[model samples]
Target: MKTIHKIAFLMIMSTQLSFAQSSEDQKIMQLSKDKWQWMSDKNVETLAALFDEKSVFVHMGGSWGKQQEIDVIKNGGIWYKKATIHDVSVNIIDNTAIILTKMDLLAVVGGNEVTNPFIVTEVYIKKDGSWKLGSLSFTKTLSPSGK
Candidate 1:
């Protein structure tokens, strides 16, 4: 009887832990989706709030810090017109969350519009009770055969 009770209690606790982790994962995923929309809209005010002071952005051209990224967006250096997200996965470690997103990005860079497949990695850290983007890096990927 005691053995059975112990087993059941452990199972319940395990389930609760799983549920908590799932909830955190969902929250981070949604935040990532919203960020894409905000980038498309050029909503720098909201993005500035979400970006950590020391956040870094890595791009095909070069890497830069938070302010330069915001400036690039604001000045139409790279207009993130849309992102067709194919898949996304998020993992949390301690106070940091890392998200991997597979997608095709439609953007206007240097006044030329283009679409490219990319695997975007975003790192977020929980700070002062809120999650802030710590880093974002994009890696271009070869498209699958055909369209």
Candidate 2:
């Protein structure tokens, strides 16, 4: 009877842990979605607050740091007009969260509008009770069949 009770208690604890992890994952996912909108809207003030000072950004044309990324968005250098997110997954390890997003990005680069399929990786680190984006990298990928 004692052994059975122990097993049931362990199972309940495991289920609670799973629920906690799921909640954290959902928060990160929502943050990522909001980030895409902020970028599309050129909300640099909010983005600057979310991005860590040491954050890095990788693009098809080049890679840059947080300030340069903000400048690019503010100056319309590479306007992130829209992002149609097809899929997203987030994993949390310790105080860091890594997110993988599959999406179609519509943007204006050098005044030319284009659409591309990309797998975007975003890393966020929790510090002082808040999360800050540490890195964002975009990898161009071939479009899936049927748009």
Candidate 3:
């Protein structure tokens, strides 16, 4: 009887942990979506709050820091028009969260509109009980037509 009680207690704890993780993941996902919206609308103020001061952004064109990223977005250098998310997965380790999203992005860069599939990796660090984006990297993926 004691063994059965132990097993049940463990199961309950496991379920609770799952729920907690799920809630955390949902918050991160929503924040990611909000970031995309802000980028599309050129809302640099919100992006600045979300991004850490020393955050790194990697793109095919080049890599830059938070301020440069904000400038690029604000100046229409690399406008993120839309992101069609194909799949998104998140992994949390201690206070760090790694989010991988596979999506088709419609962007305007250098005054040219382009669509491409990419795997976007976002790293968030929990500081003072709040999450701040530390890094974002976009890797181009092969399209269905091999483009």
Candidate 4:
């Protein structure tokens, strides 16, 4: 019947859309992991290419622009020693993706090594078919102390 045909068409369309969204999620997730690696390695050049010119980074200590963030990493103001992700979830809306990751972060800030649990929000925007980091905000779940 006509009702059956319409139902089947809708189902197919829904599945196709889900697949597309899943693909985007995977791409963004991979990029996020790569970004963490770049941070750990202090690869400011790669991060500069990935970060939007007007991107913002928020930390417990302060918030800064893309260039300032790059400078901090390059100058060793804060060293991202390691990140152990506990969970990560991603949501994609049109050309933008929002990712929330809970992790245990080990870092050396101001010459002191510390560890803390944090929830990091990372925003990415698709531009010219490539994703660029728009913003990164880190919320500490617990106060950092010597690990």
Candidate 5:
């Protein structure tokens, strides 16, 4: 009977820890939302604040660093319109978390407006008791025939 009780208690504690981690994940997701809003509005400073000093951006086409991301925004080359992101899920591993986000981004590129739906994976690493974005990878969801 004592062994059974010990096992049950451990199980309860493990569930509680998972709940705590989910709550923390909610906070991180909110930060991601805020960053997206800033990007849509071209609030470069606000967007920049969310990125870690060594953050890497693996965009749909290629890889870029912090400065490259910033430059795209500053030059008005990469802009989002009618931006919507949802169905976000977070997975935690010790001091690192992986956030998966679905995005519907509409923008004008070279005189033509385009909408690109994508799934983005963002890596958030805990540094100094705070979560900061370390890397991001995006996958295009458009059909092969450009549907």
Candidate 6:
């Protein structure tokens, strides 16, 4: 009788833990959407809040720090007029999460305007009960001409 009671208690505890984790994952996805909206509106202040102090930004051109990303946002480097996301997959690992997706950005690059599609990988980390982006990597999908 004692062993059966203990087993039941352990099962209940595991189920509760799984439910809590699922809730957190949902929140994380919502966070990503919030960040995307912030970027789409060119709201630098709000987007800046999404990145952690020790975050990394990796673009096809180069890698940048949190401040660099903020500077670009403020300077309109990305000029993210609009964006669309597709085929997204999110995975959680311990306190870390990874999001991969195909993204299309209507942006201005170096004085020329264009719409570019890229494969993006975003990493987020949970710290002090809050989740913030730890890293972002993007690989441009080029045309056959490689332009």
Cα deviation of 62 in candidate 2 (Å)?
0.5
lDDT for each of the candidates?
A: 0.95, 0.94, 0.92, 0.92, 0.80, 0.81
Measured against the true structure, the TM-scores of the candidates, in listed sequence, are 0.96, 0.95, 0.94, 0.91, 0.81, 0.80
Runs with alpha carbons beyond 4 Å of true place in candidate 5: 1-8, 143-147
Task: For residues 25-137, write the lDDT of model 1, one tens digit per residue.
Answer: 99999999999999999999999999999999999999999999999999999999999998898989999999999899999999999998999999999998789999999
lDDT of 5 by residue, 1-147 (tens): 999999999999999998898799888888878777777788888767778889999876679888788878777777765567757888889899898888777875555688888788899889999887899887887732223
Rank order (by lDDT, best first): 1, 2, 3, 4, 6, 5
Better of 3 and 5 by lDDT: 3
Preferred candidate (TM-score higher): 1 or 3: 1
Candidate 5 local lDDT, residue 95: 92
Instruction: For candidate 3, write residues 1-147 as lDDT tens digits.
Output: 999999999999999999999999999988888888999999999999999998999999899999999999999999999988888889999999999888899999999999999989999999999999999999998962224
On lDDT, the stronger of 2 and 5 is 2
Candidate 6, 1-147: lDDT as tens digits: 999999999999999999988887788878887787787677877777779988999886899899998888778787667667766777999899998767787777666788878777899998887888999887788731223
At residue 31, give the lDDT of candidate 1.
97
Enumerate residue pairs that collide in model 5: none
Which ten residues in a row are the worst by lDDT in model 3?
138-147
- lDDT score for candidate 4 against the true structure: 0.92
Residue 11 lDDT (model 1): 100
Q: Indicate the TM-score of model 4.
A: 0.91
Candidate of highest TM-score:
1
**Between candidates 2 and 6, which one is better according to lDDT?**
2
